[model samples]
Target: MIALPPELLGQLGTGLWHVFAVFLRVSAVVTLLPAFGERSIPVRVKLAVAVAFTLIVLPAVPSPQSNPGLLPLARLVGTEVLIGMVLGIGLRLFVLALQTAGSIAAQSTSLSQLLGGAAADPAPALGMFLTLAGLALAVLMGLHIRVAEFLIHSYAMFPMGQTLSAPDLSQWGVRQIAHSFGLAFALATPFVIASLIYNLALGVINRAMPQLMVAFVGAPAITFAGLFLLFAGAPLILSIWADALFSFTLNPLDSGR
Candidate 1:
């Protein structure tokens, strides 16, 4: 049997502890990340992803204090988990923005009930489509690389074993939520405008020909228009959403974005 020296054993333990500490944070973040964190993804795959991120982030971050006491270790766990959740929730808001935009667009185009249960979550068909497309686009654009950097940068903003200022965090959360709603509204603007025009023209036609059943005549027209607009405007809408998402990833606290 090969007997390892006490010094080497101590070093090994500390190193493992450091990795565990980092994993705690990484796993929390991965639970709510965009493409990689979707509900459809397997739990094992997510665990592997968290490990991969921990390895990627390990070298960049400073090592945790070696051999902490039970109380200190528990404190560290809580702190790291909370920080990870805050960062993860921030990123998740962008996904919420897409979902919100999808709901608005779907309702505006009168397509809300079509395939509403397509996704794991109970959302409108358009919402499901946009969410899936946005996730794919985000992945294609090297979301993993940006997320690694984001995780590394998080260490700077939220240092090890320190509690964040609750007031500041709360304020920041509110800002992110407000921005998400605004972004959702902006993305759905085209559909909303089209709905408005359809309503006005329908009103005029109804007035002009009281004998004609305008609802029956216009239902198909509005549905066709919605489909056409989705096909035509999707590219632009996704582009705008992607830009906002990337911007948020780059700087979560940027209120102006």
Candidate 2:
């Protein structure tokens, strides 16, 4: 057995602890974020991923001084975890855009009540479609690579043991929440316009035939029409969504910008 010197042993211990801190932060983010972080994924799987990612990122993270005390170590770990959660939640906000758009589209088409397969949370059929589409688009657009780059850059932006002001974090969080809605509206714009036109025509038809069961008759027509519109406009919508996601993931500060 090769016995290491006390100094080398101390350095190795510090490095390992730092890596653990990074893992905790990343794991917290993935636990709550969208897609891979969804509740549907097993806890064990997430833990495994976090460990894997931490190993990958350890070489990139700067080394910290050896400290055996629990308080300092706890604080350092907390900061890393907070930063990780913030980044993860920021990416999650982009996914919310698609869900919001889907909800609006569903309501417009009178398909809001339709049961969709469980995704994230139990959502409507339209929401499910939108979520899947957004996820697939993000993956296709190299989200994983961009996310890794972002994680590496984050250490530079917010270094270990630095205090992050609560006010600033709150402001950033609020902006992300607002941006989620804005992105959703942008994605659903085409469907919104289509719904308006369809509703207008329905209104006129009802006026012309007062005895007609407009609700029952128009439901099927609107559902079919909405499906058709979704099919036709999906490509454009997905492209735009992917671009927005890429931009968001690359620039965390862009939520406010």
Candidate 3:
């Protein structure tokens, strides 16, 4: 083998270190990413995706420190993992929001038991459908491209080897959770309104015609209304959800918004 120059070897080592550092964060994020990190996906596939993201993000980010001592290296590992987890969980929460909205809608319409276990997450069929559609829509709308930009931007928000402030992180986490629930409620508002109207009408009919079994008569009406609303309103609900998800990916660190 031809001998390599000392400078060339040193540069190679530095490059490898940078790649490794980036990989740590990328792998952590991929482990909890929305559709790409679903439990149903094979582990090998996830690894390939993480590696691909690392390569895409590497050039855009500032190079990490090379040749760190053992203690500093350990700290770097922990810091990167923590940041990646925070970011990944932020994206995952949007998926959870969609699930929550679907559950609420199903429960309101008395359709909660309709194939509830069909999905891997043990959610109602409605929830599973919404999640699958939302994920597919997100992917079709260039989710991968947005994710790459998000990953590169993250390096600026949480620099290499820097630890996050606990109090700030906690507050941010609270805000994100609140926002997620708020979004879910917003998406399920139509179902709730329909349920309320149905209940009121059922009560009036029962009082007006006590001889008639209002429950039997009202069930079909509510079911039909629920299905129709889903068919008509799904597009709007998904559009709202997609906007929120994209907004979050664009500025994950700004949880206050």
- The prediction achieving the highest lDDT against the true structure is 3
Model 2 TM-score, 2 decimals: 0.91
Please, what are the lDDT tens digits per residue for candidate 2 over residues 31-141? 766666776779898888777767777789887766647888778878877888788888888777888889988888877878855554767788788788778777776
Return the top candidate by TM-score. Answer: 3
Model 1 residue 122 CA deviation in Å? 1.9
The estimated TM-scores of all candidates read 0.97, 0.91, 0.97
Displacement of the residue 78 alpha carbon in candidate 2, Å: 2.1
TM-score of 1: 0.97
Can you tell me which runs of candidate 3 are displaced by over 4 Å?
A: none
Q: Give lDDT per model, in order.
A: 0.90, 0.78, 0.92
lDDT of 1 at 129: 87
lDDT for each residue of candidate 1 in 53-139, tens digit (9 for 90 to 100): 999999998889998899998999999999899889888998999999999998988899999887777899889888989999989
The residue pairs found clashing in candidate 1 are none
Off by over 4 Å in 1: 255-257
RMSD to true structure for each model, in Å: 1.2, 2.0, 1.1
